[model samples]
Target: MDQGGAPPVFSVTAEGDDDRVHVAVTGEVDMATADTMFQTALREPTRALTLDLRAVTFFDSAAIHAVVRLSQRFPATLTVLPSAQVRRVLEVSGLGEQDWLAGR
Candidate 1:
């Protein structure tokens, strides 16, 4: 939600086999909606977690914070496929250079 009207249209889906969890997200994510992404992405423990953000058009600091927390909680267990927009943000925020998000 953007806090001015109806909640933003955010969709997150996590699906994978026993050894991994694959997550996909579509839509904007700001302060009001970052928790949804975080909670959904970390719903269960797995040997690995992959986050696909190719459909995401916007993400704010809150979204980055959620990713930081998720990584801190799961350590060395996340792979991210970010859209150009997302990559820009992540690069500006310095997370783009993080090893966990590398080579995606």
Candidate 2:
């Protein structure tokens, strides 16, 4: 679901099962939508969680922060699938290659 935000915010689709939860995100992600993403991503209970950012067109520091926070909270359960552009930002933010970002 796309949580309404200021402008150019992102949409999130969350799918969950017995062992895992998957969230696919599209559009831009920034301060306007970071909290929404965080809330939506953590709304379910699962042994594993995957964040799919393949369709994201823009990612900023706030998006990076959201990923970091989720990683911290979920520990071994969180995974992030970032696009090339988002991967670059994650790398610059010192998180792209982290094991915590490994996707299922």
Candidate 3:
């Protein structure tokens, strides 16, 4: 969730396979969308997650925190495929090329 109780809704295009989920987020991921996306990942038993952020031009710490927390939950097994903007956020937040991202 970002702020104002607006949780991120998934525009999930394809069905997940082999514990690998392909997600395309198309909105702001501030505090509002944080936990929604986080739970979407955490609740899944997927071994790998590829988040396509091509449509996400805006993101925030809470969103990054969600990813980082999920990465920790998976123990360096989170596979993130983010856009440049999201990549920058991850990098600046000290999550770029970490063990988790390294596996992707």
Candidate 4:
């Protein structure tokens, strides 16, 4: 839920086995929901993790920090598929060239 009128829709779903897990994030991902998203993504502790953020509509700095923390935790095992919105932020943050980013 955001600070505005209607509560913003936010969800984090993870699938696949411990070998490789995929997490899809949708809706607004701000300070309010970033920690939940981070925890959800770590639930499985897979050898490899792919974050599908193509459906995310809003991504704040907190969200980016969460992603960075995940990347640090997983290191070589982390991969991210960023939406246009997320990608723009990553680029601005100088993280766009990270190897963890998929589809460039």
Candidate 5:
């Protein structure tokens, strides 16, 4: 679902079994939609969560914070399919190459 914000924030549905939630995130994720992302991740009762960010075009600090927060809270295995731009941001933010950010 694309959460309408100051900018268009987009994300995908995460249907879960007992152990995973799958959300394919696209477009941009900024402050306005950061909370929504966290909420969606937390709502899942799963050990594995996949955030496919292959289609994401943009994101900011707030989005980074949300990712970190979810990493800490859920302990869900997170698969981040970041595009080059988003990956650069994550790398700069110190979360890109970490084991925690690696889903497998």
Candidate 6:
């Protein structure tokens, strides 16, 4: 569900079973909303997790940090579908080549 202000600058939704969960994130992901994104994505237990950030508009260092921490939790099971905004940061942060990133 969306958890943000009036216009809802951020929203996160998760679906799938315990074996495979898909989390779709939309809107901006900055310092204020990064932790919420991380926590919401992990609200469900799963052996495999996919984070879809294609709709994110503003991705910052805090968001990248959150993604990294989330990946660490899932490691071999984590997959990230990053948007242009997120990809840019990942590339500059030297994490764009991570195995967890899809559609590289």
Residue-wise C-alpha lDDT for candidate 4, range 56-94, written one tens digit per residue: 888999999999999988889899999999999899999
lDDT of each: 0.83, 0.83, 0.69, 0.90, 0.74, 0.90
lDDT of 6 by residue, 1-104 (tens): 65454555788989999798899999999999999989988898889899999999889999999999998999899999999988998999999999999988
Give the clashing residue pairs of candidate 2, or none.
Answer: none
In model 6, the clashing pairs are: none
- lDDT of model 4 at position 39: 93
TM-score of the candidate numbered 1?
0.84
- Give the per-residue lDDT digits (tens) of candidate 5, residues 1-104: 55555434576567778887887677778887777877877676888777767777888999898887777766646666677878889988777676655432
Instruction: Please list the residue runs of candidate 6 whose C-alpha ends up more than 4 Å from where it truly belongs after superposition.
Output: 1-7
lDDT of 3 by residue, 1-104 (tens): 35786544433343487768766676677887777777666555677776666667678988888877777777655566676788788888777767655333
Better of 1 and 3 by lDDT: 1
* Candidate with better TM-score, 1 vs 4: 4
Residue 62 in candidate 4, Cα distance off native in Å: 0.5
Error of 6 at 34 (Å): 0.6
Name the better of 5 and 6 by lDDT: 6
Model 1: per-residue Cα lDDT at residue 26: 87
How would you encode candidate 1's per-residue C-alpha lDDT over 3-75 as one tens digit per residue?
A: 7775447888899876789888988878988999999887877788888888888999999998888788767
Q: What range of 10 consecutive residues in model 3 has the weakest lDDT sum?
A: 6-15
Sort by TM-score, best first: what order? 6, 4, 1, 2, 5, 3
Which residue pairs in candidate 5 have backbone atoms (N, alpha carbon, C) closer than 3 angstroms, thus clashing?
A: none
Q: List where candidate 5 sits over 4 angstroms from the true fold.
A: 1-9, 102-104
Q: What's the TM for model 6?
A: 0.90
Q: In model 6, state the lDDT of residue 98.
A: 96
